[model samples]
Target: MAVRARAARTGVYQYAGREIDPDNTHGLRDTAVVNVLRDESAVFDERAVRSFIGKPITDDHPSQPVTADNWRTHARGTIMGAMRDGEYLAFDLMLTDAPTVAKVNAGKRELSNGYACDVEIGDFTAPDGTKCQARQKPGSIIGNHVALVDRGRAGSDCAICDALPSNLFDTLKTEKPVKTMVIDGLTVDMANADTAIATVQTLIAARDAATGKVTTLEAQTVADAATLVAKDAEIAKLTKALADAKPTLQQLRDAGKAFAVIEAKAKANGVAVTDAMDEAAIMKAVVDKAMPGNTYEGEHVRIAFDALTKDTKVDQPKVQPIGAPAQITDAHTDYLNDRAKQRAALSSAWKTPFNAADAA
Candidate 1:
């Protein structure tokens, strides 16, 4: 009988009393021979024959092997169960293989609908000396298994975990949503409803101010128009009154001619007329300064006196003087008679002289 060795197991397998899987197995299969050296010098050496028999390992074994084809499905099922059990950090499916990680990522991407899922892969080492890559929510702690972010519901630690402060959870539960409005295609969130209402009121106030200014301007324009109308009416009345009071040209010329005659009469009478005196005053002064007979009343008195005293004869005659000649021219008559006698005597003497001369 020859001694024989049994074949080793490679993949996951089940035996009669135990189970073997890839988790506990390693190394490939190869053939080797057992060699024994003999020495003939010693008296005690003897040839020995042994008979050994064992069952050969066969492919007739139950296995649940993890491979690339079904690793995603198994990993997803495992992670889902761990999440439900609150043991989400226990498994590291990301470090298994590239294809397995890809499948896992795809499944994670499908978890959040219409939103981007930010799943973080972290390096971890299992207790069994295997390198692992685990999936977790972004910014999450390892042991808490809940996200460390401040969502509206206090993340996943509000109800059961109690990892946050007691007052913080109460505040989050009672907080109200912010007020929002859409302006020019952008959403604006206000602190409160009062703030949004105040903005609207500001706009209304500005519009009212503009309207008031326009109204004031219109009123001013109307007032100015009324004032202009009143001024035009007053001007028309004054123009008519002036036309009624003004003197005509012919009347002024006649008054000037009458004044010239009065001035000339006053000058001829030496009445001392001046530019300051009017026509009636200068004529009155001229009449007052006239000579008594040259006055209008004096002329009538003189004419009556002349009519009474005219053509009256004397009442008495004078007697003739004693021995006086009846003619009053006697002296002149005696001188003329003496002159005639003298002439006659001279003529007679002249004739005698002539006669004597002729007799001689």
Candidate 2:
């Protein structure tokens, strides 16, 4: 599994410069210091000693061991004077007993492309339960550890040192912000910042347009669904109306038979029936002619006609009465004689012998 680096704390001031530590409690007193302006022989000068009782030695002087009496007079005076004068010169802290030259080389090795050495500035609680200002500069391992540079005394503040910017803007001003951008497998060198920004804007505009088109399609789909629902409702209404207006099978059969009877009656009265005449028209014509000189209403006449014809017998082929005897033919007489002979044989008490003559 890969571990992601956590974001650094906020409100922690950062400086892209060196810092100075005056504390000698961590066995860092013998750490070598150098004077940049002097020759190699003056690198370990007495004034470069780590500190004289928590104070930095700024001026080169003869070597003198730190004593209780001189600690306050010499070491404390020099550092306090510098602070009062507002001298915010860059300084280095003897944080470890490592060789000074090696540490410097290590700091240089940690510098990478597009990055610079920086220090994180913040307040820290000292062993004496007092708040002290501290500076943490990048070590040789970059993010692994940091070298602490503490200002002498608690509550000592340095606004100028803590206000340095730690971003890459200063370094990038002399170089291009971006080197290359890969688009569709094609590498494009971002030589101009304006052109790169314009490309991003174009991509954003196209995405917005496509999103708008998708939204429109969704809206159209909803509208089409509503239209289908309305059409279904209309079809249902039409279906019901058709069911109410059209006659059923049984109703059609009854009306057709009644019309047939009315046509026959019209024909019997010497009236000609035509295909153009419907049941109502024929009934009206017949009722008017049959009831001539009578003040009978058409509705009453139709009712009487229907009642009279309701059980009227239909003409059928004549059939013989069930009690009438059937006429006998020669074949029937022979059949009767054969039946009589069988009855006589059955009635006899003795069994007859089988003979061809008897069969004849």
Top-lDDT candidate index = 2
Q: For candidate 2, which ten residues in a row score worst on lDDT?
A: 1-10
Please write out the lDDT profile of model 2 over residues 95-195, one tens digit for every residue.
11224224333432111011123322344543345443443332311211111113321113321121243643233443545677875454556676686
Candidate with top TM-score is 2
**For every candidate, C-alpha RMSD to the true structure in Å:** 67.5, 46.0
Q: Candidate 1: where is the Cα deviation over 4 Å?
A: 1-192, 247-360
- Weakest 10 consecutive residues, lDDT, candidate 1? 48-57
Q: Which lDDT tens digits does candidate 1 get at residues 36-116?
A: 111111101111100001111111111222223323233221111111112111111112234433543343111100111
Model 1 residue 335 CA deviation (Å) reads: 51
TM-score of every candidate relative to the true structure: 0.18, 0.20
- Taken over the whole model, the C-alpha lDDT of each candidate is 0.34, 0.40
- Residue 153 miss distance in model 1 (angstroms): 74
